[model samples]
Target: MNYLETENNTKITHFVLVGVSGQPHLQIILFMLGLVMYLITVIGNTLIIVVIILDSRLHTPMYFFLSNLSLLDICGSTTTAPQSLINCLQDYPIISYNACYAEMGISLCLGVTECFLLSVMAYDRFVAISSPLRYMVIMNKAVCLGLTGISWTIAFLTSVIPMLVTPVNFCGHNVVNHFACEMQAVLKLVCSDTSTSLVLLFVGSIFTLVIPFSFIIISYLRIVVAVLNIRSTEGRLKAFSTCGSHLTVVTIYYGTLIYMYVKPQTRESEDKDKIISIFYGSVTPMLNPLIYTLRNKDVKGALRKIAGKSKA
Candidate 1:
């Protein structure tokens, strides 16, 4: 492994990222692939955000939350893609200590926020199905704002606090074995005692992953029960159609995330981790807009209307 000369204090100044591949040719291939996906992610999500804002027909509780998710996808992709793609071009790509920390912090915050937000979305679907008349009343502007605000606060508390509270010594290892400064990957380089940091992170993962995921499952189960109570097949189909996209996205996103964490990390599994990271970090974000838009009649109608207006 290539390394930089250490300072007298052995204070780590920067980190050399091994990136996806050590081979220059392979790195270039990955870089091109990541660039195309990143562009698609940005454009697709941006279109969703724009449609949600412009189409008065879509100005509802569901679309409101969806717009926020689109924004998050854009931001999440941005958090990791630029640096990773750039690093792919160089053999020894280095990130400043502060920048690496910032990357990890932003990724963690966004990840936690998405977890809670998805649960809230599942609840929204449940309310919409279980109590159609009261859905608007229950999920009013004030209520939606409150829910999203709580999620953001939870994210900040869970992500930011742990980073600040549990300071770890890196000793002399400044080599990150991944394309991005992922939390788990960086934590592996800690040369000091990691009991506090590991525990804190583990607890935060529970709040962000296990708890939210459980809530989503319960919400969907209730939604299923409510849909089953519908007398007409069309009614049930309509209800299912409304939330099918969300369920698909949940399966793709959470499925990858759960798989990423369930196994113990071994030397052999580190590459697997890298592969999973790229999938969730970039592929999921790229697919979100597609998943939400392709099956959504409301979104498609809105897009068509926007297109007509532009042509006129």
Candidate 2:
């Protein structure tokens, strides 16, 4: 089908999403996998939020930030995973132009928010380890709330310009070469000049990806120094233990994101890129709560408590 202009003069009404694979057998496998991941992502993240809220022991700055991260993971996975799964079942998966833009905007906002949240979490760790006596005062309730609010506000604002500008310019092309309306994938479908959008996206990427990553690195460096200064091996191990989960999460999240967005794209790498995107978008969210719960004694204890209470 050819692209047609709407009454309002918009060039594209709908877009066909060429999902990760074209083969029917692969699509079936991908759909089942995506469905399973989506279920786990929602259930795991929701469990984290519930555990933190219900467990008095978890009512701390760290878990507070963790709850927010869980929320982001939920939103992030919901933004694309369901649609991707649905597309896998359809012969020609199409999304309305408006819906595509909305998906792109929300996904971008959530992605940026996660970046800021991770950096904030890193800083929280730094304060906790480096200045234990003052950690409470430093990461007070007001400050924690402020940090969370700032992350959401800045992320939404950063995505607003691109969301407003990009859809207005998509002219002839109406086929997105991915499972969902990923920003870059959707942008690739626009026939009109997207130089301004691309530039703005680059600037946003710098703030969202580069700056937050740098902050995480700096915070970890200080944390490492502080851990090294501890007198005993037990003390050092305990300090590092607290940081282990966050570092693992940060490495996985940023590593995949950098590879997905920071690296240049080529035709040959598009399929691999889509696969990586799936890993980060759907799989990572599902893994986050598992990572935190498995590595952190507090979370496990809370889960056990909750399980016992239910049994009682």
Candidate 3:
């Protein structure tokens, strides 16, 4: 390990975030773009949460879970985007070590929580379609809150444990090769052997990503079967409609996540990883509310009512 020796013989306290681009013009462009996306993400997710809360028609298990998902999206984007945007505009692009770790922890927690929440949502859809009469009874308020609590608890534990246990020795190299404090990029700076941390991270990824993804797939498969069994055309259409927005969000969310984490990392792939991270962490949140509202008639109606009331 190449430890640094300062004038007073101490280690560096901060890290340089080598953002997406080194060129000044490119950095400015990225800053502007990131800012726009961040604003949209916050506003859009907030709107979803507000709509769900204000509208009595949306007071069902589905919308309740959707509101939770929106909140997670907001938190996820907030964790990375603000720091990234600031870094983009700065000449030194520096972050304190503790701040970087905090960012990583919060980002991971929100992301893992979203993964489990999405699977729970898939189950909600399955129950709604597979057993319509008992949907309310099955997914009562207590059960919904319990499921959300479990997701948050598991996510926080998984995220915090590895952060606390993992050994991160920056040595002399304190430059991170991406905008945000991404796990892989940060790990690359470690001077010590990171085999244990790597193993733990892999196991955590399996629990947070692969297992939940498999559950979503299985739930959707059953949903497809049930939807097909509907005798009437309108019935089949309604069932598919209910799952379509969720399916789209899941595909986009998991696609970026799988590409970012599941693939082999190499020198050439680092840039690609950052881009995909931005997609899931920033762009996806902004798009989610649009996907749900544009596709969902109930949400549209609620928006209309809200707008009409304001006009009056």
Candidate 2 C-alpha lDDT tens digits along 1-312: 234464467667788888854589999999898898999889999999999999999999999999999999998898888788889988778899778878887888898889999999999999998998999999999999999999999998898665764544555667777888877777675555566766776777778899899999999999999999988998799779878878888888888888777765432327677888876788778888888888788999999999999999
lDDT score at residue 15, model 1, on the 0-100 scale:
82
Candidate 1, residues 97-212, lDDT tens digits: the string is: 87888888888888788888999999999999999999999999999999999999999998877786676777788788899898778878876777776666666666688888
* Overall local distance difference test of candidate 2: 0.84
- Model 1 CA deviation exceeding 4 Å by range: 1-8, 261-269
What number of backbone clashes does candidate 2 have, counting pairs of residues 3 or more apart or in separate chains? 0
| Reference-based lDDT, each prediction | 0.84, 0.84, 0.85
**CA deviation > 4 Å runs, candidate 2:** 1-10, 166-168, 265-269
> In candidate 2, which residue pairs clash?
none
Q: Candidate 1, after superposition: displacement of residue 6 in Å?
A: 9.8
Residue 51 shift from truth in candidate 3, angstroms: 1.0
Using all chains and alpha carbons, the TM-scores for the candidates as numbered come to 0.94, 0.93, 0.94
